[model samples]
Target: MSLTDVIEGTRQATAADPANAQVSFSVANTLVPGTATAVEVRVRDHRFAVDEPAPLGGTDTAANPVEYALAALGSCQVITYQFWAAKLGIPLEQVKVTVDGDLDLHGFFGFADTRPGFTDVRITVELAGPADAADYEKLKQQVDEHCPVLDLFRNPTPTSTTLAQLTG
Candidate 1:
């Protein structure tokens, strides 16, 4: 089956039942002992490590969480561009996305009043296709409006945290 068919089928299903559009995703993370800042993360069947650099007191065994955040944004942008271009019939040949973010350590360390997370993020999308500039621009607009990760970065989401304790 084609991507368009899949997309259309999803649209139809969600339209038929709004519950079909409601979905949740989750990941589990555990701090690795004997490490300054290392986390084991599991998403479904996949597993990965997240660690900080030496400057942050970690052994630099893997990419940090912030780096993964940037990667997520970049990869999502690429996927959104491909999907939107196909749906819009823009004749896309290639899509590449670059993402960068600025962060301040003061907030994380509680040394000053600053945001601990990324203050700003920038994305650049490169496309190689026969489509005109206006068409590509339109495609970008559609992607900006539709991409889920972009929305997550652009807007604030309601979140909550709870602590659970276990005794051995």
Candidate 2:
């Protein structure tokens, strides 16, 4: 769709149901322990797999959990770039995001008090557009403020896990 279409859609949605501006998403994972490192991931009506690389222990069948996390961040950034560019009147012809995370082996192996999550992450946003640098900067600032995944990473969101028995 064109940027104008997206802008109009967003405007209509927000105007019709402001509450929808705030939303929630759900995801589920079921272990497929039959494989060395694979899990059935369910998000809405879609089903996929998440796995670890061979070096870490499992077959290099799918992206590992950490990689998925980084991908999530990158995906969210991509979404925000387009969404905000449309909203803020920035012209973006093309956009690409490259994300990387640094992790310490000791943290994952329980050898140290280091963080089990990414020690840090870097994301490079490459763009091809007619907008000037200042316009790009303005759009980026808006994206930084609006991106949900970016907010989740930059700020602390309290999360609790619950375990329950499932009977089939």
Cα TM-score per model: 0.96, 0.89
Which residue pairs collide, candidate 1? none
Collision pairs in model 2: none
Candidate 2 lDDT tens digits, 1-168: 877797798779999999857878899888786786788899999988888888888877778888898999999999889988887778899989999989999988999988887789998999889989999988888988988888888999999988889887
lDDT per model vs. reference: 0.92, 0.87
lDDT value, residue 53 of candidate 2 = 83
Give a tens-digit lDDT track for model 1, residues 1-168: 877888899999999999999999999998898877999999999999999999999989999999999999899999888888879888999998889899999999999999899988989889999999999999999999999999989999999999899566
Instruction: Give the count of colliding residue pairs in each prediction.
Output: 0, 0
